[model samples]
Target: MLSKAFPRRMTVFVLVMLLVEFLDEFTFGVTETAWPFIRNELDLNYAQIGLLIGIPLFLANFIEPIFGLLADTPRRRLVMVGGGIMYGVALLWVASSQSYAMMMLALILLMPASGAFIGTAQASLMDHEPDRHDQNMARWTFAGSVGMVIGPLALGAFLLIGSGWRPLLVLIGGLMMLAAFIVWRLPANAALRSHASDADDAGEPEYGLMDNARLALGALKRPAIWRWLILLQFSDLMLDVLFSYLALYFVDVVGVGEAQAGLAVAVWSSVGLLGDFLLIPLLERIQGLAYLRISVVAELILYPAFLLVDDITLKLVILGIIGLFNAGWYAILSGKLYSALPGQSGIALTLGNVGGLFGSLIPALVGIVASHYGLQAAMWVMLAGPVVLFIGLPWRTDKPIKLEESAAK
Candidate 1:
C-alpha cells in the first residue's frame, strides 16, 4: 500500500520498518496471551510471572541503548539483521522451554533482541521525514496494532487446531525469520534510510564508540527529552503493562475461562487497531499534543471504571473504549520525543531505554501487590498511568510544539 503511494526509496524503507514492528508485537501478543497456560503448566505464582516479565524488561532496557547507538552507525544493517536473527532464535528457545530457568534465559535474550531489531527499525523511520514524526509514528503504531490483533487470534486458531502455545510460538518464530529475510533483502537508499544515520546523529563515522556514547548522553540535558521519555514509561502502565496483565485479570479477577479470556484480549487489541489506524489522519488534522491532551483526560475516567467493573461483558466493552482513548499515546508521545531530538532517532531510543530502567520493574511490583492484596487491589497501580499523563503533559495544548524552547521552561 505504501509502496504505491511513495517513491521507490521510501517504499522499501516504510515496508521493512513497518514489517519489523508488526512481527515484533505479534510475538508479544502471543507471549502475553499464553501466560495463563504457561503459568498453569509451570505452576508459577503471580510474583513469579511478574519476575519473568519484569526481569527481562529490566535487563533488556539497560542493554538496549547499545543497540540504539549501533543503529545510528554505518553498519546499521548488520545490527538490524543480527538482532532479527537473535530475536527469532530466542522465540524458538522460548517455545522449547519446559522450565522457568529456560524461559527466563530465552526472554532475557528476547528483550535485547527486540531492542536491536524493532527499536532500531523504529529509529530508522524516525530518521526519515523529519517533519512527519507524528504521522509516521501513527503508521508505525497502526502496523504494530495489526500484528498485535493477529497474535492472539493466531493463538486462538492454533488452540482450535489442538496445538498448544508452544507450537504456535514455534511457527511465529519461523514467521519472524521470514520477516528478517525481508529486511535483509530490502534495497538500501542513498538518503540514509536504514543503513546510516542522518548528519545530526553521525558527526563522524570514524569517531570511537565512547564519542557516540557521549553525544547520545547529551540528549539528557534537554528537559523536553526527559519529559517525553518519562511519560512514555508512565503511559505503558495503561498500555503494554495493562496488556500484560489483561489476560490474567480476566482469568483470575473476572472468573472467565480460557476461550473467553482470549476473546476479551482480542476485543481490546482490535479496537486499539481501529484507534491507531484513525490516528494517522487525526495527526494531520490536529496538532499531536492537542490530541494527546484529550486522550489523557479521557483515560482518567475510563481506567478507574475498567478496574471497578465486575461484569465480564461490560468490562470488555469498557476495555475496548479504554483501548480506543489511549490509542495514540505512544505514537504521539514518541513522535514528540523524536521531534524534540530531530535527526537523532537513535538517541531517542537510547534515552527512552534509560528512562524505562526503573519503570520496567512495575509489572513485578504489580504482581507482588496482586499476590498480597489480590488482583483487584493491585489493579489500582495502573491508574497512575493516566494520572501521571494528565499531569505530565504540558498545560498549554493549543499551540504547536517548540520542544527545545519549552524544555527549558
Candidate 2:
C-alpha cells in the first residue's frame, strides 16, 4: 500500500514543477510576445517566420523520444534539473541573437532542453498516483496555465512600458536559472522511485535504442495510436499554433495595438487556468472522452464565432469560454495514452512530439496561405482542426494497461 506521506511529497513535487513550468513558459511567452516586434525588426516574410517557429519545434520532436527513454530511468529528476539549466541558457542565447541564424540555433537548443523536463515531469506525476492520473494531469495543466498566463502579460507590460522585448528574455533567463536550482533541491519522493525499483526487480528487459525503436515501429501497427496522433496534431493547430498567432492576429487582422493583443493572449490563458482548476472537480462528473468530444464540439462552434465577431471584448469573452471548454483535452488525452502504453512513457510522449512536429507546420502553412489570401482567410484553415478531431477520435477507448502494475508481470 502507498504511504500517506506519498501524497504530501507529490504535492511538493507538483509545486516545484509549477515553478519550473512558469519559468519555462515565461521564456517561451517572451518569444511569442516579441514575435511581432521581431518580425517587424527583422523584416521577415511569413515563410521565414514560419521556419523560425517550426524548425525548432520540428527538431524537438526528434529529441523527445530520447528524453522519454531517459524519463523511465532513476535519473529522471536529475534530467529535469539539467533541462532547466539548458532552457535558461538557451533563452539567454536568444536574448543576444542578432541574426535569424543565431536565433534559429538558440531555439534548436531550446527544444531538447524542453523535452528533458516535460515528459519526465509528466511521468513523475502519473507515477506518483496512477489512480489519480486525470486529477494530477489537471494540476499539471493548471501549472502550465499559470505560467502561460503570466508570460505574455509580463512581456506585454514590458512592451507597454517601453522596456522593449530583449530585457524580458534576460529576466526570464535569470528566473529559469533559479528554477533549475529549485528543482535540484527538490526532495525525492519514494513512491515513484519504488515503482521504478519494482519494475526493475520484475525483470523487465532493459530497453535500448533498438528496443525502443522496435516498440515505436510496432506501435504504428495500431490504428488507434496513429489516429490519436492525427487528431492531436489538428487539435494543436487550434489550441497551440492558433494561440501562437493570436497576438499577431489581433495586431495585423483585428487592427488592435500590440499591448491589447498581448492582453488577448493573457485572457485566453487566464480563463484556461480557471478552467483547469474547475476541470479537476468536473472530471468526477464527466467522462474523459465525452468531455473531450464536447469540448471539441464547443470549439467547432466557438472558433467560427470568434472569427466572425467584430467586437474585441466579445472575442476575448469567447476565447475565455473556449479556454474553459478546451481545458482538459490534453490531460485526458495524455492520461489515456499513457494508460494505453503502460511502461512506455517515452514512446507515448514521443508520439506527442511527432504530433507536435506536424502541428508546427500549421503556422507555416497558415503563413503561406495568409501571404496569398490574407490573414483572415488563413485562419479559416484552423476550422479543419476541430473537424478532424470530431471525425477521428471516438468517445470510447479500449481499456488501457496500467503500466506500473504490468511491470510486475
Candidate 3:
C-alpha cells in the first residue's frame, strides 16, 4: 500500500511537489496578469508583448529534453538545485527591471532556469516510485491546479494594492527560493542512489551532450511516439491559445471588466483541480490511452462551442467543461507516455515538453492570424488540431518498454 511505502518520505515528496507547482504557476500568473501594466509603462505593442510572453515557453520547451537527459545521471540533484536558484534569481531580476529590453533579457534567462527544475522534478517523481507513476503524477497535477488557482488571484490582489509589478515579481522569486529550499532538503530515494552506484560500478558509457541529442532523435523515430507527440502538441496549442488570450477575450469580446475577466480565468483554472483529482483515478481504472482519446475528442467538440456562445453564464459553464477535458488529457496522456517509455521517462517526458514547446509557438501564429482574421477564425484554425488527431488515431496499445526492476530493487 502507498501508506506503507515511505510515509514520511511521501509527505515530503508531496510538499515539494506542491512547492514546485506553486512556483511554476505563480511565475506564469504574475507575468501574464502584470502584462498590461508593463506594456503601458514601456510603451510596447501587441507583437512585442507577445514575444515577451511566448519567448520563455519557446526556450523552455527546447531545453527541457536536454535537461531530462541530464537528469538520468547522478548530477540530477545538483542540476535541480542550481536551476531552482537560477529561477528565483531570474524572477528577482524581472521584478527589478526598469526597461523593456531588461525585462526581455530577464525572461530569456528565466526560461532555462525554470526548465531545469521542471524537467528534473517530473523525472525524479517517476524515478522515486516507478510502480506508482499514475498516482504520483495525479498528485503532481493536483498541486499544479492549486498553484494555478492561487497565482492569478495573488497577482491581481497585488496589483490592486498599488504594489506594482515589483511586488508580484518578488513574490514569485521568493516562492521559487522556498521551492529550491524544499527540493534541496529532499533525501535521495534508495532507488536513485542504487541506480547511481550501479552505473558507477558497471562503468556505463557516459553520455555527452551529442549522445543526448541522438537519444532524443532515436525516440522520435518511432511512429507511435510521433502520434502521441502530435496529439500532445494539439492539446497544448489549444490550451495555450485559450489561456494566453482568455483575459483579453473576456474583456474585449465578451464585454467584461479586467478584474472580472481575471476572476473568470482563475475560476476556469480552479475547476481543473476537480478534474485532476477525479478524472485520474477513474481513468486509471480503465485504459489510460483509450480514455485520453475520448477526452481529446470531447475537447475538440467543446472548444469550438466557445466561438458560438456569448452569454457569460454559458461561457463559464463551457469553459469549466473545457478545463475538465483539458486537465484529464494531460494527466492521462502523460501517464500513458511514461508507461510506454518506462526506462526513459526523463527523455520521454522532456520530448513531450519539446512537443509542447512547439505547440506553444502556435499561439503566436494564432495571434498573428487573429490580428488579420477574426478571433473566431483563429479558433476555427485550432479546430484543425482535433480533426488531425481523429485522423491520426493509434490502432492498439503501445507496448510498454520493460526496464530492469532489480536495479531499482
Best by TM-score: 1
Q: Residue 388 deviation, candidate 2, in Å?
A: 1.2
Q: Candidate 3, 65: how far from true, in Å?
A: 3.3
* Per-model lDDT: 0.83, 0.75, 0.70
lDDT ranking, best first: 1, 2, 3
Name the regions of candidate 2 deviating beyond 4 angstroms.
1-10, 189-206, 401-409
For all predicted structures, in order, the TM-scores are: 0.92, 0.89, 0.87
Which of the two candidates, 1 or 3, achieves a greater lDDT against the reference?
Answer: 1
lDDT tens digits by residue: candidate 1, 288-352: 87888888888889888888888777888999999999998999888888887665677678888
- In the range 1-409, model 2's lDDT, one tens digit per residue, is 4787566546777777666666666666667777888888777877777788888888788877777666655556777778878887888888888888888899889878877865566776776666666777777877777778887878767877889778888888788778778767766553234245645553444466556666666765666777777776777777777777788789999999977888888888888889888888788787888888888889999989999999989998998888888888777777777667766666677677767777767778887888888888988898898888788777578766533444334
Query: Which residue runs of candidate 1 sit more than 4 Å off their true CA positions?
Result: 1-5, 8-10, 190-208, 396-409
The C-alpha RMSD in Å for every predicted model, in order, reads: 3.4, 3.3, 3.9
- Measured with C-alpha atoms, the lDDT of residue 184 in candidate 1 is 78
**Candidate 3: segments with Cα more than 4 A from true spot:** 1-9, 190-213, 374-376, 393-395, 402-409
- The lowest-lDDT stretch of 10 consecutive residues in candidate 1 is 397-406
